[model samples]
Target: MYAATTIGGGLGTGLLSFYLGIGVAALLRTMFGYDAWDRDFNATIGYIFGLVGWLMGVGMWGTWGREWFGLKIKDPHANSRKELGWQRYFMFNVDHKVIGIQYLATFLVVFMTAGLMAMIIRLELMGSGQDFISNKTYNTVLGMHGIMMVAVAVAAVVGGLGNYAVPLMIGADDMAFPRMNALSYWLVPPVAVTLLLSPFLGGLETGWTAYPPLSVLTDSAQTFWNVAIITFGLSSILGGLNFVVTVMFMRAPGMTWGRLPMFVWSMFVTAWLALLYTQGFAVALIMVTLDRIAGMGFFDAERGGDPLLYQHVFWFYSHPAVYIMILPGFGIALEVIGHFSRKPLFAYRYAVGAFLGILGLSGVVWAHHMFTAGIPNYLHGPFLVATELISIPTGLIFLSALGTIWMGKLWLRTPMLFALAVIFNFACGGVTGIFLADVPTDIHLQDTYFVVAHFHYTIVGGEIFGLFAGIYYWFPKMTGKMYNEKLAKLHFWWMFIGFNLTFFIMHWPGIEGMNRRIADYPESLQTANLIVSLSAFLLGSSFIVFIYNFINSWVRGPAAEANPWGARTLEWQTSSPPPVENFLTPPVIAGHPYDYGVPGAAPHVTFFPPAVGSPAGGGGGGQ
Candidate 1:
């Protein structure tokens, strides 16, 4: 599909669009200023214009551009299935499954790249005083690692797994808006490329938060970072919106709200979080971008801009963004727990209620990230209370997990193991979070490695582990292949042990007052840092085992049976890897999604193959 024609899906076309954008940017700069050698000006313009041309070159114009202009096209959903082998993955395909695969492949690649960046950071920290890279380079690597991983955390599961699974689970042929789904996904590449290309533009060092004054004074690389963030926010907002509409309107008949799968409910709540709060962070980034490019100085204290104002706007979305990152993880964990334990989700309605409760509390606790930033004294008490109170909903997730596992069959499969690990991991992370939420303790731990350890416990331990659980649990259904379970077990043990050794020990140095974002620490902390670094290397290397297993299994593993786990969700009713239309006819929901042990219960969804005289199975499905 991506031939080298005017409209195709080829790297050559992407490059052509790229160079065209650079040329347009250069031309405009020359016209606007006599001195046109400014790299910042050229880079900003070229980056923006390049993505436009890249969009056109990628067949976006041919697919949705005509639709935007209200013109009809022939076969709008063409090439969605594997009509041309794996090339559909690289093309502008409209199938939710293909898009989901594309997203999974894309973000995993980014994750590995960012992981390499993190290894570089750990190498420097391993020895103390600037082991290899310069402090400036170290800072850049650290910031890039932070932001890229943030991108992975924010988008990987929700965009990748959610997009693929939601339609199938809901018994829909496709997303409520398939074209819009494609659009949301397509926006990601250019923005990711822009952020990845920041190093050549002097790199960004203001950290992922990009607090201003530092951000305002940093090199023009920050401009690209700003644009990347705003662009990503736009994509996230659209994705969240698409998920909500699909879930709310397209579920299988008899699948009431209470009958919805935990993962779908999680996505539904996550979508609301994304829709309502993502713009706060986007607006903050936009203001900073304007400060960099347009000289607006919204955060420049010298220009009467309050730097604290940036923190307020940034954290409003960012703190909720923490929930945005983990809520889906919670859903995934519960889904795995219920399936593998041979039980219905414990307190299903309460868990659903807790998800909503978390969303309601997410916004009020934003101020907690700013407690030590010199807010009013009276406000601190309420903020602290709100932050601590959010943990009630968080605890309910754990309660449900424990309750479900009590006296259950407890299949210790890869997914279940990882699911169980999530509870353990998030427990440690959440306990520390309570300490951090208290004003007195936070004052002591502020800017220390304790904070770092706390978040990694939540994000890496909680979210990433949950991500792997989802990947393993859904692997058979998504790809029609069984992963090497032994290798997956090895991956889990290596990662779990190494993860604890690395992050758990990391907290001591913080308690000993090791500040974060620093190139060097006290000589006394060197042994601790080295141990953390070495274990981190081990933790990082465990991914190598996973990658090999993921690839080797996808190509050569045993074929999976439909409904391998005997899952009761609507998705497992369809074929493994699912058909192009998901269901030949719309699935008829019969009962609760996770009523696994219920005696004499019908399947959640019953599938009938396509009628003999109908179009049947030529990748024939509706939008």
Candidate 2:
């Protein structure tokens, strides 16, 4: 059944690509003569051909099923797990845990590669002017850094950890569509590889923003980047769909909507944002490709194409993209807080409300990213109000965090430490974001390092910290081993300090008018630049502790119990590194996931042992 769906989807995507390609070609030929065989036209044709060829290959292998010419058909079941070896990782498996690990491993590889690009950018900025590479090379490197980091941030939580943990947390065997989950994850590598090799295709100089006019005139890197982006976007869309369906349809018996785990809620909201906005970016990129390859003039200013149109379409997705990145972190922080504090989530209803509010507000804030881009003055007020209103929902997140920690036992463990760091850094990021959202202030800070510092604080401080929290919180559950407490704490301190040292100082540079994306800076700012460069190196090296700790712990750490944190979530009820089918017998839900305490109640850990025929104590069983 899974194989058939996989083959059918692939074929459908392929056929759609073919018709779109031919249609585009026909339009070009009819508008221009055959003599107008331009670079754009050739690139478009090549892209379509590649898509068609890939689909045809999949069809031939799966539908035709011929191993050799005139050979007898082999039984599909002939080669079982014994024959597959490690090759199963390359194919779709129904196991959600396996898919999770796949996401984790792939994103780690991409993260490392992108991190190296950051190192190169820092090296060039180490001194007053460009030293290691030319300005063009430096710009390309920086562009790759931005684009790849965006990919990493977008995928790290949702694709990597979320894929692995959400189903388990919700007490489901797998995603509603396990095969589709596998497909989404598998799509990542090819896109990542393409982006990595973009430099060889002359490197895209428009930064990750890929703003037009400039993008249209750039080399093949644009083509490669566009296609790669489209592919990645498709992966996001599929993943989003799977998540939405799984959360809605696959919760264990008695797991009511209000009883859902915070992380699950976070994933649900993030998935909605992804579903809503991913297609916009996909469409915008597709149009850009049409303009570049077919001379369609969609964004070509001189040929009646409006350059501002690109900004509008791009941010329509990109702004929501930020929520997709941070909301998961909010979920992670809430999870960590509940466990470490031994408390129910503070203001649970408000936290959920905040998630929905952010989703609605995300679309309105895109123009905040475009304040200085020749937009009408009247337009700025509406976007600015909508942008500022987001802070109200975002403020609730802080209230939940601070309230949970106020009178509770704070562990200050590696995970908790990262959670604390997330609070501090995200606060700084969120506060600074207000300056950018205000049209008057944004005019001055728009392209400056202030924007850079603001996001790094939010993304790195918020998302990256949350990622570490998840890693530390769920490491045992995922791997059945404990990470080194001492080493984990050490890693946290170094990372926390190094991150601040690197990015905190950047705010001043932005305020002082240091333009972003440039390799060279003025002589007056040399000392600050040097400081940021050195701090960045230290920040980069901080990952060493994490690497050593993760590898050593996986092989040698003490065996982990099912419920390390003693929380009420269903995932903790199962064995560490859970069985292939997840719950050996179906799990029964108990009280709300965050029921840390209730008057006169014994502090007993809840478990739905197989013997208990009735649903666990809490809410009624699922309707």
Candidate 3:
């Protein structure tokens, strides 16, 4: 079977090379007067080897890697990418649309997996004193849930919608480097495998933050975690590079920056942030890996290394990582709000500036995460102030959403419902964030269930909500089918209510001194924990509606129109699912995409040039 040769082959060769790398590490370790069977050393070396084997097996070597050795490159297998329907989703197709679906499907699986882990966590907290699982098991579940969701937050919108929509919106045929784009996706399988393998290896003890002294000292599967995240970072960096180049050079004629879509602008800013900062997390983990296997002292307090160094480097990227997750989210919400409200995006230039402002301020606010980490006293106020300052840009974005809805026609569709909720949910999230940004309050709230509530409010409420808005808004364009409207609205209301009740109640318990990552707590807090657990189960069950709706609709839903919402964006002008080149004829820019109500409004785009004195072409000069 073709599947056997691609994904299956990757698994097979990956296992073999993994063992080979262990053997090689053994030989080198023995030669250097170390033990021949060092688990840390062998696993570290094995993962590096395994990653390459996986890539090469999955068509990377034939399609792209061969060039490094001065060899001719080919499709890497016999199957034609022209294969239609669900088959292309499985194949190594370079069409950005297929790759977009691939990322969505992959991360959706991950999201559900992590969501189940969340249910287990909630179940254990249903009773006090570790009744359901050991403290160790609880920590493992918590860590896996945290990290997996972090992965979903980081990649889902950017990798899914960003990939599918950006090229089409910008009127490009495909990503600038199609091979590199494929490589970015192929790299994810190994990272997923590595994370799944960790629980068997000893279970993750530290949280996703992976702070050093504890991270370096844990006897658990830190090496596997380290290698997996580093691989993931490499994938993100490459994807970012591809996006940056594509947006900069591949836009259609007259697709200047000023005329770009909000979604495209968001991706552009997010790509640069990811490209520039993802390495800090990778390099920090690399040092942690070296500390474990190579016996380096990057975080060893006994050595000259300071543990604080890890916090500094990790938070540097991890903080900007917050924007990386939320920026596209805001982009999606803005994009949806613009179309559904039937208005030109209010102060469009200000919204774009808000995105850039976040990008600029994202790095400087890293130290706020470490306010309780025992850094120097003088560093506290500046980081606090900088953290608060970033809110100015965020508020601008928030107000843009509100202003777009002010007196504009409201469509009240599923995507619009989600878009409207984004404004409400993030307002709650932003308020809590302000408390955490202040030194006096954060010192009390840091490491508690309050932080947990605040975090979910920001990420799940902000980014994941935006993600659904996009999925609904683009469902017709991407799948050539219409989702059941009633079911979608059902899923939306259930999820929104459940999510709010669960997290909003979670904050009270934390304020009452309920700590995070603990399996046992005082009997005094039992009542509130019970409420939260019940509400969490309610929240978790709402996804069942989504799973069914997504499956049923995608499989047998009705045919869709090319432009379901009658928007002015270029993507809606193309066929549902689009052709190989995206458009049958190249698109020529004619006017601003969101301009909705001029007396003689020129279409945002046209397949052919328009003639003079045409009322329909009132917004344009002769093409």
Q: Who wins the lDDT comparison?
A: 3
TM-score between candidate 1 and the true structure: 0.95
* Tens-digit lDDT string for candidate 3 (1-623): 66657777788888899999999999998998988998888888998998888888777777777778988887532333556446667666678888888999999999999999999988888877778888788888899999999999999998899999999999998898877788888889889988988889999989898888888889999889999999999989998999999999989877888889999999999999999999999999998888887779988888889999998999999999989998988999999999899988888899999999999999898989889989999999999999999989999998889988998999999999998888888999999999999999999999899999998998999999999999999999989999999999998999999999999999998999999888888988899999999999998999999999899998999999999999999999999979777877778887888887756877789875433443241221367
* Count of clashes in candidate 3: 0
In candidate 3, position 395 carries an lDDT of 90
Local distance difference test values of all predictions, in order? 0.86, 0.81, 0.89
Model 3 C-alpha RMSD vs. true structure (Å) is 4.6
Residue-pair clashes per prediction, in order, are 1, 3, 0
Q: What CA RMSD would you report for each candidate? A: 2.7, 5.7, 4.6
TM-score, model 3 to reference: 0.96
Assess candidate 2 and give its TM-score to the true structure. 0.88
Give stretches of model 3 more than 4 Å off.
76-84, 609-623
Where model 2 places Cα greater than 4 Å from the true spot, the runs are 1-87, 600-623
Worst 10 residues of 1 by lDDT: 1-10
